[model samples]
Every structure is written in structure tokens, then in C-alpha cells.
Target: MAKGHRSQIARLRNENKDTRPSAKVSYARVSVTKACFVLDAIRGKDVTTALGILAYNNRYASSVIYKLLKSAVANAENNNGLKADDLYVAECFANKGPTMKRIHPRAQGRAYRIEKRTSHITVVLDEKK
Candidate 1:
């Protein structure tokens, strides 16, 4: 049991030691599925191309993701001393967040529950090999 704990600790430490610059947008007013559509398009894509795609994409989530991608690139350049041109999106994903419960009035004095979903999106940028 002690040996198992040691390995688990090592794994946790390694996971927390990522050097790539990343940015996260939490509690974004978008569903995970909608955010994933935009994130999928930019995963493994270069920063410039990803920016262009986000700029012209019609999805509502794209606008939120565009700001996030820019922030990640800025983090890489300013904090990590990396060139924006040399960076690519190494990882991008969206996770489900809390839902805002709302009530919609209906006929006969009834009310319908509405759930406005939210998501937490993250983008990690790394230098090209």
C-alpha cells in the first residue's frame, strides 16, 4: 500500500509540473458541447490559424474562445518568453460547469424549470518541435 501511494504521489506531482502556458475561462455561459465544437477545430492548430478560425466562426462560443486563445498566446509570449509564431495549441478542452436554474412561467399558473448550462474551457499552448 505504501509503495502504491508513492507512485500515485509521483504521478500527481508530474501532472502539476506542466511548463506550457495555459489560460482558463471558468463559468463561461456556454454548454460543454457548444464549446467543444470550437475547441476541436483549434486543437493541434497553430496560433495564427486558430485565431483566424475563431475570428470568422459564427458560433457564440467562438467569441469567448477567441479571447481565451489570445490570452493563452499572450501568456506564452510574455510569461514564458516564447514567440507567438512558434506556438501551437497543444491541448484544448471544455468541462461542464454549474447550471443556472431558472423558471419559465407557463399556462394554468404552471412553471417550467430551465437550466442554463455553463462550462470551463482551457487552452494550453506549446512551442513547435
Candidate 2:
């Protein structure tokens, strides 16, 4: 209510706002679109259920994502001092990263350009509030 106390309230709000742990895997050799396919299936789901979804996914990105998700859940439990069962995959997504350019040999003394795509994937989990 007082001027000096307003800053304290703000700090408390920030501390209480989703202090769960997260993990990020950057420069993954996968495109954002491909990663999103797997992320879209697990977003807003419990940790166990999200892992289940990742396990059965046929996409190649799922393997990497599954490990990242597990890391996030572990972080929540160990670092953030939160229970794994109380957390869920609040957010998961991938963004395009740097592209590697290469030249491929072609017929008639020509060259073909190759763009190797990369992505930065992040998984954020939070306790159900």
C-alpha cells in the first residue's frame, strides 16, 4: 500500500511467476518446421504424457526433443526445487538458427548451393497453479 512496499510486491510477484526450470538445446541440425511437428503434439501436457508423446513420435526430431524434455523435467525437480509430477510442458518450440552454405558439384562445370538449416529448441515447464 505504501510507496516503499510497492517494489517488494513487484519482486514477490516476479518470484512467484513461474519459477520453474527450463532447458534449451541450440544449434540442432533440424528445421523449425520439423521440430514444431513434435512440439505441437506435447505442448500444455503433463510431463509424463509429453514424454509418452515424444517416445512414439515417428519424426527424427522427436529423439532429440525427448531428451531435452527429460532434461527440463529434471531441471524442474533438481534446480527449481519443484516436483516433477506437479509440472507440465507449459511451452515448447523451435526457432530457425544459422544456415550453413555449401557448394555441391554439378554437371557442365556448374555448382549447386546447399543450405543446411539449424534450429534452436527450448522447453519450458511450470507447476500447475
Over the stretch 1-129, how does candidate 2's per-residue lDDT look in tens digits?
Answer: 435588888987788786658999999999899999999999999999999999998899999999999999888878878988898988888989999999999999999999989999999998898
Best by lDDT: 1
TM-score of every model versus the real structure = 0.89, 0.84
Full-model lDDT, candidate 2 = 0.91
TM-score of the candidate numbered 1? 0.89
Backbone clashes under 3 angstroms, per model: 0, 0
List candidate 1 segments past 4 Å from native: 1-16
Write model 1 residue lDDT over 1-129, tens digit each, in one string: 235688798997888898999999999999999999999999999999999999999999999999999999999988999999999999999999999999999999999999999999999999999
What C-alpha lDDT do the candidate models reach, one value each?
Answer: 0.96, 0.91
Quote the positional error of residue 56 for candidate 2 in Å. Answer: 1.0
